[model samples]
Target: MFNKLFGKPKAKGKDAKANVKTVATALSSMERINENLDMLEKKEQILQRKIAAELAKATEYSKAKNKRAAINCLKKKKLFEAQAEQLAAYQLRLHDQMILLEGAKATTDTVDALRSSAVAMKAIQKQTKIDDVDRTMEDISEQQDNMKQIQDALTGPVGVASDFDEDELEAELEELEGTDLDEQLHESMSNVPYAQEPIMSSPEAAVPIPAPSKRTPPEKTPVHDRSEDEELAALQKEMAL
Candidate 1:
């Protein structure tokens, strides 16, 4: 029902990789450098073994008093030492090149990442405008107001209850309160004790108190004597005799 007042989102696709060197190229270069270093290291070890062998031959020749053979062996050992030093220098150069290549690769990756971010930001900014944002915010505020009105309507009192007069309710409540007050006053009056003031025996305030009244008992009814019945009984007894 409120569809026209709302907005949706848009999804952007990943851009194609630009003219950066591929990972395979960097890996191949690193592998080639490492292989060269490894080969140089192996040659260095072989030259070391050869130099040791030449020195040992020179020592044996010197012990046998052969001065010319000893001198030749010493010269050969010096040549082997020179070759080993050259191999070490080559390994060092290769190591330095590998470090520089790695640093270059990292710098390239960082630059590429920043460039891609800039491109994405530009695309999004082109798709969205300040005017569009303002309009969307206005729509959201209007929708919120509309929802609040709906909630108030839903929660409002209904039917006769809503139609009740406020003034009449207030008047009825006041009347009930007045009646309750009157009853409370009446109860307080009934519970209160009556106090009579003492009258001073003076001419100005001589009020007389009445004496208590004495009740008289009722007189008994008169009764005839039983002498007549006794005399009749005595006469009947003489007759029966």
Candidate 2:
């Protein structure tokens, strides 16, 4: 009737919950084990002290030559030795458990450290790439500025003015040379006379002069004077006579 009212009792065995609870319990027990180890170490020390005291009592009994006391002291010594051995075994087990737990903890820490390093390396790589891009942009900007400066120098007003001055100087020099040549020619012309005659005369002016002709005397008139001449001769002869 109760089975019918409550349906059926649940079967209890090891389940997921139970397994989790077991692992939790084991971890709790491990903590207790460490505490117990510390307690056992203290107990071991006490047992070692007891064993030494028993040994001293046995030795004193042996020297006293008392058989019953010596036997009792030997029994006490044996009991102390047995307790010490049990404590030593418990300490050995605790040491093994502690060694295993320490190794597991070290391995877990190492894995975590490696994961952290990998994440840091990824961050560093990203930052380095960004820095490189910024540097490249800066370099390009600097180069552009330098090129602009060079272009300005090539096309500036000073450059044009210098070229203009050179051309003007060349033109002035050519004009000066032309003026000097004209002045020299004028000076030479002024120094020489224009009216000087040629050393050799022309052919027409070189003709020779002709000589003068000879003339004859006029003829004498003799008949008219002959009669006069005879009379004059007769007078002259009479006066002489």
Candidate 3:
């Protein structure tokens, strides 16, 4: 349904622009591919010529009985054949890409034509709506101005609330100052230094001690009688005379 309304839904302007860029890139790539193909073709022709020359030289050497030279020429011919096969494969790949690029070119041209028609139709519609667009723009500007004024009225500095009570705040500050003064006075009075008292002597310190008394020696008595001792001795002497 949208395709029917929009005339097959032609490519957007941006898509058309991208398609143009892709076409330019594809063209450049095609040119490089053609150059490569030409180089490959030339290489293939050179290899064919070299192969033919080497085969002829090998045949002549073999006829003359130079086996070593003939074998070297055969090796050269094999190398040329291998190179020619590789170039043929490269040519086939280039042909395939050229066919694909041709198809893409046709599709790009068709899309470009459709986009051109769509752009023309869009330009005509824009011109027809010019008056309506101007009126809408004016209405939007008026609404924006009214919105800005309302926002400013709500958010301005003088519109904000005050959080402090002046009289109550002043009384609280005065009470705090009186308390601080009383604390300072009490601290000063308690911190003053006091005088120290001297120690006194007691009466017990003046008393003297008494000396010890002297002791007398004991007397001794005689153990035997002297008169008895003398009578014994006289009787003994008379007997003897």
Candidate 4:
């Protein structure tokens, strides 16, 4: 039983170590493949140069009418071309292997990252539950409400201005306006002159004054005002004498 318990962990550890080594080996192999590909490319370039040189020699020999030398040069060019083709095929296989290894590495890395992320998520969930999240949200909402209430209290009006009677305010305003209007009307009335009766020469008796087109009520005229008008009329009559 103890062996069964302990053996599992040992096996798991060994498997993990093996996986790491495998990944490392894959990366090393990919590097080696790239190096080999580079070597193959260099070899192909040299072969192409040799082939070009051989073809040039073949052309020169053909121009000189030396068929045997030209044929030998062409044969050398064919060998070089075959070697170049073989190198190209090797490079192509290496490239395909590199692409597959890179793809596999990327997939393995992605899976490992996702597994780590899932583990992190599980640990976070263990520390913080759905119920805890709900409680936190409620606390936040409560704090927001309390802050809003505090702000409202701080920014509110200081007095009971809004609680005052609207009717009483309107009445006071009306009384003030009426008092101002009365003073203005009285000032205008005092400035107005009484209409005068005009006298003519010895042949003419007197010309009666024309009636005013506008008039105010007798009750509307102030009591002190009637006496002033009468006094003005009496002074005018005396001046005529």
Evaluated at residue 117, the lDDT of candidate 1 is 81
Candidate 3 similarity to native, TM-score: 0.43
TM-scores of the candidates are 0.58, 0.42, 0.43, 0.55
What does candidate 4's lDDT look like per residue over 1-241, in tens digits? 2223212211136646765766777777877997898899999999999999999999999999999999999999999999999999999999999888878766765666676678789999899999999999999999999999999998866678658887999999999999999999998876765433224434554435454435442333443656755655554454444
Q: Write the per-residue lDDT of candidate 1 for residues 126-184, one digit (tens) a residue.
A: 99999999999999999999999999999998998999998999999999999999999
* Candidate 1 lDDT score relative to the true structure: 0.72
Clashing pairs in model 1, backbone N/Cα/C closer than 3 A:
none
Off by over 4 Å in 4: 1-19, 137-221, 224-241
Please report, in order, the local distance difference test score of every candidate based on alpha carbons: 0.72, 0.66, 0.72, 0.75
- Candidate 4 at residue 39, lDDT? 91
Backbone clashes in model 3, listed as residue pairs: none
Task: Give the range where candidate 2 is weakest over 10 consecutive residues by summed lDDT.
Answer: 2-11
Deviation in angstroms for 5 in model 2? Answer: 56
Compare the candidates by TM-score and give the number of the best one.
Answer: 1
Q: Which candidate has the top score in lDDT?
A: 4
Residue-level lDDT tens digits of model 3 in 112-179: 78768788999989877978889999999999999999999888555223456679889999999999
The candidates, ranked best first by TM-score, are 1, 4, 3, 2
Q: Model 4 Cα displacement at 66 (Å)? A: 2.2
User: Model 4: number of clashes?
Assistant: 0
Write candidate 2's Cα lDDT for 29-113 as tens digits: 5677778998998998998898888788888988998778888988988998898899899889888986775565445446545
